[model samples]
Target chain A: MSDPILEVKNLKKYFRVTNGVLKAVDNVNLSIQRGETFGLVGESGCGKSTLGRTIMRLYNTTEGQVLFNGENVHQLKGSRLKQFNRDMQMVFQDPYASLNPRMTVGDIIAEGIDIHRLSSGVKRRERVSELLQTVGLPEEHASRFPHEFSGGQRQRIGIARALAINPQFIVADEPVSALDVSVQAQVINLFKRLQEENGLTYLFISHDLAMVKHIADRVGVMYLGSLTEVAQSHELYRNPLHPYTVALLSAIPIPDPEVERKRERIILEGDVPSPINPPPGCRFFARCPKAMPQCQVDTPRWIEVETDHYVACHLYK
Target chain B: MENILEVKDLKVSFHTYAGEVQAVRGVSFDLKKGEVLAIVGESGCGKSVTSQTIMRLIPSPPSIIKEGSILFDKKIDLVQLTLKEMESIRGSEIGMIFQDPMTSLNPTMTIGKQITEGLVRHQGLSKEKAQKEAIELLSLVGIPRPETRIKQYPHEFSGGMRQRVMIAISLACRPKLLIADEPTTALDVTIQAQIIDLLKDLQEKIGSSIIIITHNLGVVADIAQRVVVMYAGKIVEQGTVDDIFYRAQHPYTWGLLHSILRLDDDEKSELVPIEGMPPDLLAPPQGCAFAARCPHAMNICLNEDPQTQIIQDEHSMACWLMDKRMRTEIR
Candidate 1:
């Protein structure tokens, strides 16, 4: 659809640990449309964050290409890299740790503007104030330090900072997971509103499935360092194909007591296997309830089983 | 059902440099034997403080139990207990599990030693006997190869395994009351389900009453029979899980239920977020704590505090909207 704003081809990110290489992101391929929110969902340590960081070039890619606007992000240097920085930005998960506690909110938001030379002097200050208002914060809050605000307010400041560069693509890594439920709703709504207003594309990474469903146009479920399923948000939630995705969807406890009592939960048998020197087949073979003999020895191929629905599982094949 | 714990008109405040911060303002609730009660609220809402007070765990000097009595087992008031008396009650009669298992556990020691230390102190078991019991406890919590895992230190265990060890240590003495403060908040959804199931199984076996303090309504609905909704250092509502989920009266509870993006709800329905932040404890409003955020706030809600109105059997809420006269008048 009009050439995806960002594309990842066989992307891999690995960290060298004391014992062995930890394959955090392994041979992942994805594409994000120009103005749609793409959700990446998985449990902790499942490489969702690593994939997001790799896409944003926060971490150097071990093997593969991150193409932004049809240019390889990993190959960019100097002026091209600076241009890439201005075009792509990231909003981190922990608002408490992401923002500098000592800096004023104005300075934090203007950091991007100053780095990209987008504005200076009164214009920069005015831009910061405008961004604060855009994110539903008051202009007066610009003078205050990050420590003076609550978790929700700090997150708003972080969003304002990301928007400062006027980026086309923003990687929001678990932006609302650290927030309270009520505040999370506010931030999610803000994200939707900002997208409509600014025409921005987002790669929204979160563990909260319900929240992700509400905000994302497309959803991808990742297992240990590999994507298991990808589909339209409603399609994925209604009919999850991968065994890991099905178990994960069933595990989310519904709020209504009656429904919760009647629902049959698929409790996965064991914890996620170690990413370091992961098993030599399907990453989810050990915990997948529908696992077959081939699942233990052969890695499943990613296949488009339905219209716009992709799954990497022997069952789908 | 026999009342295992009764807290009446409990008030707690922190004597801080920014003046006395009234943390828990005149809250009260009761827990029955073998019942699972959940305290649901956002941060700074005094849900944790209430649990800490019940366990007699709040640090003093800066913290003070200004008023109210916590009657545990209908035998003693925990508020009046000295540090020595509370110590005797802490691990033996009541156990606590925190959100982060790593911090709660001693990383320097082996998992077996940590679990056995409580047994040795409370049950008067010899080291050898305690070690044997510790392995069994580990197995009970669903840790594989408990015999070998026990000898390894906390660093060797994964987050889920570490939490299981914490649960084993907490249940070492078979405490009648177990307080889990957001036990699954730090774990993954799958791991969270495992922990919740483990707690349910253990509760049935040990016959211990549980008080789970968390912000997740889904978790509360999954494990809790009764629910308490707290806001701005006060309990806004308390009822059976069905009543809270199906027939919630307080506007804050409705806001909370509506705010969350539930998998069962209509995908297109816009989430109705409560408008404002929680009231600051240092300068709390004279009226209802949630009035500022409530969409249906009336004039009386802004000027006067709403008393707890008994809505039905085992259902009570502190909101003017639930008052019979107010409801009739509004309709």
Candidate 2:
């Protein structure tokens, strides 16, 4: 499309471990438009969260570039980066630890506003109250501490805080995984509402493919730090070319019993290989049902199997 | 198909200084032999307590099975059984697997030792026999490199590996009925699929019924032959999986089904979340607890709790909307 709001090119992050090096995020590329939710789905320790933090520069990437508004975000220094902070905000998965427990809800949301100097005194309070109401919570909840609220309420508070900076983009890292299912639905719809109201760009990271399918316009499937598939939500679900995507989709329990019984199952055999020593070729080869000799010899290059649908599986190649 | 286990008019309450919290209120359901029964509900629905009570696993004083008869194997009433009898039943005739493999496992023990411990102690098998059985269990659960992984600590295994290990340990004695409470909620989608498939395979190999308790509608969708919908400590709906899925009549079931974000649905691109929180169990409404949030709530819904009305075969619901009196009111 036209210049993306955010572009990540061959982003990589490695950790020096006793075993050798942990390749948390391998050569990966993706883009998020100005007002779109780009969902990144993978299991725990698959480096989805690491990727989000890396995009926000919370974790320094060992290699690759994160472009914000066509500018390399990694290169921004001092005052220049401070301005970047004003435009982007983040909400963490664990609400219990994400927000300062000691701080009142009002103070937590206001902390970002004060840092950005977005408003002052009564005006800031009014803005904070407005944000709270927007997320389907009362302004009176602003005075309560994080513990005072239920898991769902606490997440709403976190959402309120993210909106405090009036950010154009938000990195929501597994934002609903820890909450109850019904409450998770609440937080998810809140995100949708917030997106519509603010015209915000989102890098939604989660292991819940079901949740991702609900909010995301486009989804990128990751395995061992590498992207296996990226496609529009409708197209991907309807026609998942990648073996991993097929397995993941089949695995999701469709609330209907008849469909569930009849739904073809793809049971991957082996666990995901460690990122530090991801196999010589495709990360999914060990578990892929359609893996061939070519898959074991070399990693499949990301190719467009259909219009706007991308997959890095030898089956497509 | 006879009832493998029957829970009749179960009432569980935890006595606390704050007051006795009515955790489970006259909840009852039956699990048929060789049939997978899923207890589905959101948090604080008393599914866990009900399952735990069947195992006589609930600690007393603060927690008590205030009233109910848990008929296991058509003869043994678990609620009346003593600690000694419960111990024999556990891991031998009935087994349980909890969520969060990290906490469920013994950190001090190796995977092999932990798995074999239940076999050796409960079944009275020799250590040598138990060790061999443990290895077999590990392999059966599809834990590759099982021989080596058995010696590894819980920390050494990945989350998926650890969960498989938990399954291996739980199935050591091959209990007739296996209770897996939110077993795969903490696992990734791919790994979760593997685990679910493994459970299904194991169940087929050995003719054992499975009871999967989870809030995830997606998880219960596949393996559960029948499903029970719980809310605020009572079963709001119970029926065959087909009945629950396609023709769920209860408002709560409709809300639950609609609320869940399914990966399989294009319509769920924007998941319609149910507004308002579940009622506090300590103060469950005199009428239907879900009446507060029910879109089609009638005036009688707030005045009286509807009886469990049967609709067609094996499907039942508790809601004023389904009550014959409400039908007349609507007319």
Question: Candidates' lDDT values, in order?
Answer: 0.92, 0.86
Model 1 chain A scores worst on lDDT over the 10 consecutive residues at A1-10
Model 1 per-residue lDDT tens digits across residues A79-116? 99999999898999999999998899999999988877
Q: Is the docking of candidate 2 incorrect, acceptable, medium or high quality?
A: medium
Report per-candidate DockQ: 0.81, 0.69
> CA shift at A124, candidate 1, in angstroms?
2.2
Candidate 2, residues A1-317, lDDT tens digits: the string is: 56589999999999999888899999999888889999999877778888999999898889999999988998998888988998889999888888898999999999988887879889988998998998889988888888887788888988888888888999999899888777788899889888998899999998887778778889999888889899998788888888888887877777777777788877777677777766688888888888799888897898888888999987765
Q: What is the interface RMSD of each candidate, in Å?
A: 0.9, 1.7
User: Residue B98 error for model 2, in Å?
Assistant: 1.1
Q: Could you say which candidate leads in lDDT?
A: 1
CA RMSD (A), model 2: 2.0
Clashing pairs in model 1, backbone N/Cα/C closer than 3 A: none
Model 1 lDDT tens row, B43-83: 99999999999988888978999999999999999999999
B38-146: candidate 2 lDDT, tens digit per residue: 9998888899999988888888877988888989999999999899879889988888889998799989999999998889888889989988888888899888877
Q: Against the hidden true structure, what lDDT does model 1 obtain?
A: 0.92
lDDT of 2 at B102: 74
